[model samples]
Target: MRTAIVVGAGIGGVATALGLGRAGWQVTVLERAPQLGEVGAGISVWPSAVKALQQLGVTGLEKASVVSAPAGMRRPNGQWVVKASALGLELPVMVHRAQLHELITSGFGSGVTVRTGVTVDGFADGAVRAGGEELRADLVVAADGLRSVVRDALYPRYAGPRYSGYAAYRGIADVELEDGGGETWGRGRRFGFARLIDGRYYWYATENRAAGAVGDVWSAFDQWHDPIPELLEATKPEAVLQNDIYDLPLPLVPFAQANVALLGDAAHAMTPNLGRGACTAMEDAAALVRHVTGPAAIPAALTSYDAERRPVATKLVRVSRNVGRVGQLDGRIAAAVRDGLLLTGGKVAGLLARRRSG
Candidate 1:
């Protein structure tokens, strides 16, 4: 049987290993951490990603579990900018990050082996050196995340992560919310919330700040609408997760080189504006598994995976970065112009939806 080694045991890495195992490849998962788990508050799984997981042998997600996109965009003052129903946007199922990770990892089959505390140091043709030992396989998959050592080593000259001139704060809040939550956009900052399946709110906020600058982020939204402040109040200060936003530069380098393939943030980390980062990574794994399990040779399979995922991921990265730029517009005049355009666009979209439904 063909064998594969997947570096990193995060959501994307585990998903890749599970898919390869289901596809009949013996997979060894290398996790640098002492144990297997995921950090973060909540994750938004889009429909396509859900199907991709199912294709990878994941189950238990009912069609009904998909929720409406947050009720649309709002102003920091709670005024409506555009209702989600108006935009007729595709919705995603919100889940706790750890829960989603567990769900994907649960699909691991007997052909799969996991090695924690195995910090991958470097790699060569179909082999990887980790923790003072070298292991060889038919294929090597690098899913080591944004600061991927494999990625860095492979393309030492590759211009890596480009900061998005802002930072994001995310948390799960236990506060009660009557209405479906949505995003509140303001000048140079924004706040969004969504109800998770477990009866809690998954909220995220962004603001323009110098990289690595930390302070009371809540102060910006404190005087905003009801429940905005309450959500923060309910979340413990330390529990709120924050990260400076970043995405790989456009025309992302190819996903495959020799017998190795890069997956997830290692390949296409993007700003969170579109909420498609993790979902895209899962899709990449599915594509890799599909081609590998097909009649094509492994080399051809890697080429197909690269061809299929790179273009799509490139487009998403571009659009998501553009959205962040527009969403974080500064200055009163700029925001007013943005709100006007959005309101007008919302009306047009709502009318289109109404016409279709009618």
Candidate 2:
């Protein structure tokens, strides 16, 4: 029986392990965290990732997540800027990041060993060095996220993850809002609120701030009208998760050596502009499962996986960066343009609607 080792045990790593285990490979997952959990507040799962869930026999995202088509943007006042019907194939769903992680981790059973608190430092041809142990495997998956150990050692020339010059503040609150999803744009910033799986409202705000800076979620956003203040006030300070958005430059070696491949943020780290980060990782895992299922040589399987994933991930990295510019638009002129776009009815939806179509 062929053995595969996956590093990280994150959404990407767990998904890859489940896919490979189901395809009859012995799998071992290494996670550095003491406990397998995520602190991120909320994530939007788009159709591309939903397809991956369906492929893995996962269903009822509405049960595990909050399902609401984005109701479009509005001003700080109670005026509608834009409205949109669910145009895409799958209605966008938002869920707590930890819940989604739990769903992915639950799929692993026998033949899938999960090791928490173990860090993978580097990898050679067909083996990984983790916790001073040299573990050999037929396949090594570098799904270790933005700071991928394998990526750093294997593709040194490839630029590492860079900050996108914006910080996001996210939290889930007990504010009693309507059961729909809504986003309101302010000067150089955006706030999104949605219902969660547990009947609570998940609220998030992004602003152009210094990398790694903790934001004043309430004081900074208090000027906004309506539920913004209420939601922020209702949210406990401890519940907020602050993140500095980061992304990797593209066109590097998505695959390395004969027995190693990269997946998810390890391969193409991108901003959460369209919430496609996890989705693309799921696609990579699925494509890998398909390619390696046949009796093809290890190199051939890796080639096929890279062929299917590189172009898409590259495009996403670039697209997410561009979208970040739009969402993080600053200055007087840019804010006016953003407010105007949201103020119009169909015009705002017409232009911004296609952004998530990918």
Candidate 3:
């Protein structure tokens, strides 16, 4: 039987393991954490990612259309920049990150073996050393994350994660709210929230700041419009999670080196501006299964996977970075210009929508 090793038990890593298992490949998942679980708050699963999740064996993900109501980009004072109905945006499946992780892990079969509390020290020539154990496999997947050990082994000299000059605060507010949440943008900061599948609200705030700076989520968003303050108030202070945003330098390439593949953040970590980070990783896992399940050998299949996914992921990384720059614009004049353009663009889009309907 074909054997594979997945570094990191993140959403991407687990999905890859499950998919490989379904493809009849035995998979060993290594995690430095002592237990298997996911942290963080809500995650937005776009339509494409929903399909990928379904393809990977998650079910009962029906989201009611009622959640897609009147909402749009707004200012700090709650002025609407662009309405959702006008944008005709596709609604994503909002879910708690832990719940989503559980769903994916449930798909794991006997062929998948998860070893937590195991640290992956490094790799060389396609062999991974984890927890003092030198491991070899038919394939090595670097889903480890931004500071991936496997990725360093494959491309030691490549520039890795670059800071986005912003940090994000994420949390789940157990309290109920009546608003159909959307993002509120202010100079150098932004806040967004959405109703999760489990009836709680997931909220996040981004601020332009130096990496590793201490933050007060409440102070950052307290002056914003309704529900922004409320969301933070409802959230436990300790439950608030913050991380400086970073992305791997683009051209996300050579996803496969020899028999090893760089998956998820290890390959294309991007700003959450478009919320495509995890979604794209899920897509990578799906694509891997598609190519590897065929008659082609592992290396050739991974080559096809890299060819198909690299371009798409690269484009997303670039766009997301640009969006982050705009979203986190700290200068008052620049932010005003950005909002004005977005409002004007939204009007034109609305006009086009009406014209097409007429």
Candidate 4:
């Protein structure tokens, strides 16, 4: 059996290991963390990602997820810019990030092994030095996050992740809401809330801020709509997690080199404007497995994976950046123009749908 070593045990790494194991390859996953887990938050698993999970033999997500009500854009004062009914797009199922992590970790069978607390020092000649041992494999899949050591090692000259001029705060509250919840956009800031499967509410806020800046989360959205304040009040101070948003630069470095392949954020980190970051990573896991299965050779499989995933992921990165820039408009005139355009676009779309139906 072909042997593979996967670095990092995030969702993408674990999923890749499962895929390779199912493809008759012996796989070992190395994670630097002492244990495999995720910080608290909720993720929207879109239709495409759901399909990818199925392809990787992961199940039970449907039972564990809350089918989201249609969502729309709103102003800070709770007036709807576009109603949920007007969206006309299939809504994603909301699942807790930790729940999904546990589900994926539990799917590993006999063909795959995961070792945590193993720090990878370096890679050479198809071998990775970790835990004072040299381990070689037929393939090395780098699923390490945004600051991927493997990626840096391969392409030292490539510029890495760049800040998106915004910081994000996320938390889950134990309160329930009647409406599944939606996003509220304001000048240079936004807040969104959604129901979680566990009878809790997941909320996220973003604002233009310097890196490592600290302030009160409540103060940030104190003037927003009703539920926004309520949710913040319900959240414990320590539960709110903050981080600066960052994405890989355009004209991406090749995702694969020789037998080493970069996956997830390591390959194509993007702004979370579309909530497609994790979905795209799941897509990568599926595509990597598909191209690597029945492989003519390891290098050829890596080449095929690169060819199939790079173009799509690169496009999404650019699209997401553009969306972030538009969403973070701070100027009063610019915000007005944006809001008008959104209202107009929604009306036009609604009109087109009505005409087609009639």
Candidate 5:
């Protein structure tokens, strides 16, 4: 029987392992954390990601539920800048990252082995060194993450992720919302909120700074505008989760080498501006499984994966970064221009819809 080793048990890693196991590969998943959990607060799972989850038999989304609704954006002063329906599907269905992790982890059957508290240092040929133990397999999938050690071994010249010059402060509060999701754009600052399935509002704020914790991030937004202060003040400090935003460079040059292949953030990391980060990762795992287990040669399958995903994902990364600029526009004139463009162009509506679809 074919054997597979997947590094990292996060969304991408677990999904890949589950897909491969379902495809008849004996799989082992290595996770550094002692126990699996979600890193960020709330993640928006769009239709594309949902489709992939359905493929993997992740049937617990409704049970581990966060709120589901259409998403919108506003200015710092609390004025609506842009609004759009989620269309046939909900723009975002809020779910705790940890619950999502649990959903994927539960899919690993007898054919899959999961190792927690184990860190993968590097990989060579068809083997990975994890926690000082060497394990070999017919194929190694590096679903590790942005700082993927496997990716570093495969392409050291690529270095690692780059900071997007902004940090996001996130939290969830038991506040009454209008049953919708919203984002407030400010000068080099941004804030947004969504109603989670648990009936709590998931909110996040962004600022121009390095990727790390800051003192009193809510205090930083105290003077911004309406609702901003209310949202921050109403929440407890313990609930807030903050991290700097970063993205991997695109054109991942060569996504594979012989029996090894990169997936998820390891392959094409990008900003969350479009909220397609996880969705794209799920798509990558789904696409790879179809090819690898469908009678195509390893090299040929990888070639097609790169060909099909590179152009679409590269475009997404570029567009997402540009959207970040739009959200963080500084200066009075720049803000005015952004507002004008959004209101007059009516082009943003379609662009946003496309983002959700991908």
Candidate 6:
């Protein structure tokens, strides 16, 4: 059996290990964390990610996810900017990040070996140096996240992730909303909330701020709307997770070199504007499994994986950055123009749909 070593046990890494194990490869997953887990925020798993999970034989995720109601952009004062019902948009299902991580980790099925607290020091000569030992494998799948050591080793000349000039705070609140939640936009900031499967509310806020700046999320968004303040109030101060948003530069870094492959953020980390980072990572896991499972050689399979995934991941990275720039407009005139265009565009699209139906 082909031997594979997967670094980092994030959602992508664990999923990749499961996929390779199912493909009859002996897989070992090395996670630096003491235990495999995820943060407390909720994840919006779109239809594409759901299908990818199904393809990987991970079941029960759908049962644990809540299909989102029609949601759309809103003004800071609670007026609808672009109603989802009018636009006829499909929303993604919301699942708690921890629950989703548990689901994926549980799918390992004894075929994959997981070693926690193993820090990979370096990758050289097709072998990984970790825990004072050099381990070689037929394939090395790097899913070590945005600050990936493997990526640094591969492209030393390339500067790493750039800050997106915004910081994000995410939390899950033990509160329920009568109306299904959506995002509210303001100058230089935005807040989004959604109901999770377990009845708690998941909300995130972004502000145009310097990296490592500390501020009060509740004070920033207290006057936005009914549930926005309520959600913030319900969430404990300690539960709020904050991070500066960062993404890789355009003309994305290559994802494959020889028998090694980069997965998820390790390959193309992006802003969360499109909510496609984790979704695309899941897609990457499935795609890697598809190309590497056949009778083809390991190097050829990695080449195919790189060829197919690079374009899609890079496109999303660009799109997500653009979306963030537009949504985070700070000037009054620019914000007005953006809001007007969104409203007008939504109305025109709705009219066109009605005309087609008529």
> Whole-model Cα lDDT per candidate?
0.88, 0.80, 0.87, 0.90, 0.79, 0.90
TM-score result, candidate 5: 0.91
Kindly report which residue pairs in candidate 6 clash with one another. Answer: none
Model 5 misplaced regions, further than 4 Å? 85-90, 211-215, 224-226, 347-358
- Per-candidate Cα RMSD to the true structure, in Å, reads 1.5, 3.3, 1.6, 1.2, 3.4, 1.1
Ten residues in sequence with the least summed lDDT for candidate 4: 82-91
Q: List the residue pairs that clash in candidate 1.
A: none
lDDT of 3 by residue, 138-188 (tens): 888889999998888888888988999999999989878898898999999
TM-score, candidate 4, is: 0.97
- Residue 339 in model 6: shift from native, Å? 0.8
Compose the digit string of candidate 6's lDDT tens values, residues 1-358: 8889999898889889888888788999999999889765889999988888888878899788999878888999999988777766667999988888889888786679999999998988888999899999899999999999888888888889999999999998898679788899999999998998889899999999988899789889999888899999999999899999999998887899999999999999999999889989999999999999976888898899999999999899999999999999999999999999999998898787677667
lDDT of 6: 0.90
How well does candidate 3 score on lDDT at residue 319? 98
lDDT tens digits by residue: candidate 4, 79-117: 889876764777899999989988887888899999999
Q: Write the per-residue lDDT of candidate 5 for residues 295-322, one digit (tens) a residue.
A: 8778788878878877778888899999
The per-residue C-alpha lDDT of model 1 at residue 114 equals 96
Q: In candidate 3, which residue ranges exceed 4 Å CA deviation?
A: 63-70
Query: How far out, in Å, is residue 144 in model 5?
Result: 1.2
Q: For residue 199, what is the lDDT in candidate 5?
A: 76
For candidate 2, the per-residue lDDT at 326 reads: 76
TM of each candidate vs. truth: 0.97, 0.91, 0.97, 0.97, 0.91, 0.98
Q: Which stretches of candidate 2 lie over 4 Å from their true place?
A: 59-62, 86-90, 341-345, 348-358
